[model samples]
Target: MDLPTTLAEKIAALSDGPGCYIYKDAAGIEIYVGKAKNLRRRVASYFQARDGHPAKTLRLVQETVDLQVIATDSEVEALLLENVLIKELQPRFNIKLKDDKTYPLLAITREAFPRVFCTRDRDQPEVDFFGPFGSAKELYRAYHFLMRVFRFRVCDLDLREDDPGRRSFKPCLNFHIKRCSAPCTTRVSQADYGEDIRALRAFIGGRNKGTVVSSLRERMKRAAGELRFEDAARCRDQIQAIDRLKERGRLRDYDEPAAPTIDIHAGMERLQAHLGLAAPPRVIEGFDIAHLQGTHVVASLVQFVSGVPNKDAYRRFKIRGEAGDGDPGNDDFAAMR
Candidate 1:
């Protein structure tokens, strides 16, 4: 089949980047909206030899008189844009997401001490949604994970800053269990809660992971300097959680199979051989230290017996030596020692 000159030229000029593409008919009505990590290759596939193409795909190609592309910084952005466009345009080819219920979004309500939850309702006013995630299971998994990390309020209580009852209201079990920050009470101010929401937004929007982690570390250091050990610990925990989330995302991206179970005795023999030890080491110990700018320095020691961790032998120590009179310095080696 001969290609239209204009279509061919547009395809030739397409950027080799992540983006969403829209296919339109003669009437300039959008028939399809699709996302691609490589816009050029993906869009070109539609115009290739049509012999093996599906009936629906062939129809889509035949009817596509014109097309448009919107490039994005990354594939995640492209996916998000594709979802929004599909919902707004109701493109004929986007059958999978024609109904909003097909994919769920994580929404953050726009209010004092905003609420974060998973929903299929995109039309909710004053709400910002993060995703049309791959599946309900994945969406809920992320939702729960984020809730655990952020500790935003899960309750539907209409919390207001000026409400007289807010200060007197009793916090729920979520607060006691450290699941919710208890914004319903006066403990968490609107401004402080807003910061948490903003951080959550940046995280879910796929912003630079390093930047978020760096910001949290700085907060941890500041809190530690102010002698707010609890606040510093919270920041430290959030940073660790973000690191775990990033690692999880990387594993998911690779879609790699789980590693086979380790052979404890064989592994111990190999380790002993590698180290040229006199015997296959029956006991091994590892030490690591955590600190916020040298303040609140803590070290953990884990023991392994025959290549398996011995949970009962684990110990945690507070590095009192590093906590000098008024000033502290990051001396990880000393703390470990």
Candidate 2:
């Protein structure tokens, strides 16, 4: 379809920064909302040939008659705003994302030996919930990994620090396998158990991660110094595992601030000057590949305005069967093409 003169003008006027864009139909009703790092690039893509576009996208482009944009300071801010707008507008083409209820949260219950488990409920105010993870299997993998490394209790034995008889209780299978700290039999003291839980909390929060790792390193050195090779080896293994997980970017800190407070305009000016561009890159678009091994691959396009993410302009595409090799997987170059 040929671009309408009015729509073409709007596209040409789009700023090259991070922000969200809304698509409206002929009746002036919103049809789609998307975020982009570069508004001009992302919005312009819709008007381009529909050869590789998704069926839904093609249809959306055909129906769009107007565009609306909202610029933000940071990508994280844009994401938060986009989520809000999507929920409020419920545009026809926008995919409904799962909220907190659909995902499981890793919670630490308020008890003497706090029970850590995956839960759907936020029933108790005292209980700390770490996440509402999208993938339960992946979440469990992380949880189990932490359990093995930290040896925190998993069972609900109602054991308390004040209970004198707790020491006589038999250890469970997890305890025997060294997967648990054996709180039921008091093999690990309350102080030590609390320390482990605190460390675990720090790790989950994504704050003080370096501190936790540094502590582990120190412990490893001390263990080796005492000629406790087994303990030292265990520390080394745990450290390596933690580092691997960090490298994979599996751990996310939802509570962490998106970015420090800074002069966004100044940053843009500096970037402009450094790149020697005609104008500051106020709006930008980003692309990433998502996959489970080589299967179920997809591509995501994100928009940013003034270096802030615009979640509303975000777009996702399922890799077409023909785009992949004989085996299904992520083909980043092919997807980009």
Candidate 3:
């Protein structure tokens, strides 16, 4: 199936990088939105084979007359951007998530002390919904994990900052167990609780993630310095949880078949041919840099042997030089060098 000349040119010029792609119909309406780790390869795959693709995919390709791509710094960013676009655009070929009964959403209630919980009821008012997550179980797990870290209220109590009744109200077991800050009992101030809620929102929304992690690290260090071992431990655990969240965004459990096993030697031969190498390359190394709002920049390198990750060969480096000074001092090119 040959693509239109213009579309083919666009495909040829696509970056071999992580991004989201949008397929537009003849009327210039978006019909489908998808993410890919390699923009060129993934987009090209759609045009290359029509034999094994589902009927819906074939139809999507047929209707698509234009293409658009938004590149991201990483694959995780691409995944998050794809989710936001799918929700906002409601593309024709994308799965419908408007039915509240079908998928679960993580809602943060609009109250003095906002309650974070998972719900299938989208009709609820005065709430911010994070997802129509692919799995209710995974959503619930994330909800629990977030509660553990943020310690936001999960109760139905009408908490007001100046509510006199809160002074006398007994806190629940969650407060005693340190799972909640007991905003209902006025044990935690509205301002501090609000800050936690804001951090939670930013973390889930995948914005300022580096800042969040860095803030947690500082809190952990301060707690340790003050001999507050429990607080320090809690902060440490929160940091680890945030790292896991970064690694697996939203826990999207797709009901797709498992990927077939790779043939290492065949893959190596293909890789050699593709790169015009004299012999099949056995080792490949990849590098990425991370920083907190351009400070504390660090780089990581990972090795792949025979098309498989060699975790033992992974290394991390603390970037040094004049680039690490001043506010917002991140220099990707200098760091790479």
- The lDDT leader among the candidates is 3
Q: Which model, 1 or 2, shows the larger TM-score?
A: 1
| lDDT for residue 180 in candidate 2, whole number 0-100 | 68
Candidate 1 lDDT, 240-325, residue by residue in tens: 77666423432124221223212233355667899999998877899988888668877899886555445668899877764444
| lDDT of the candidates, in the order given | 0.71, 0.67, 0.72
How good is model 3 by TM-score? 0.51
What shift in Å separates residue 178 of candidate 3 from its native position after superposition? 6.8
In angstroms, the error of model 1 at 214 is 2.1
Q: List residue ranges in candidate 3 displaced over 4 A.
A: 3-21, 24-29, 35-49, 64-81, 98-102, 134-138, 160-187, 214-237, 246-337
Pull out the clashing pairs in model 1: none
Q: In candidate 2, what are the lDDT values of residues 141-243, reduced to their tens digit?
A: 5566676667776553567888986656656445555566677665766865776687778666433557878887997898799887765765676677567
Residue-level lDDT of model 3, residues 89-112, one tens digit each, is 898787665444668787889898
How much does candidate 2 score in TM-score? Answer: 0.43
* Best first by lDDT, ranked: 3, 1, 2
Query: For this target, which candidate reaches the highest TM-score against the unseen true structure?
Result: 3
Task: Show the lowest summed lDDT stretch of 10 residues, model 3.
Answer: 253-262
Off by over 4 Å in 1: 1-102, 164-168, 246-337
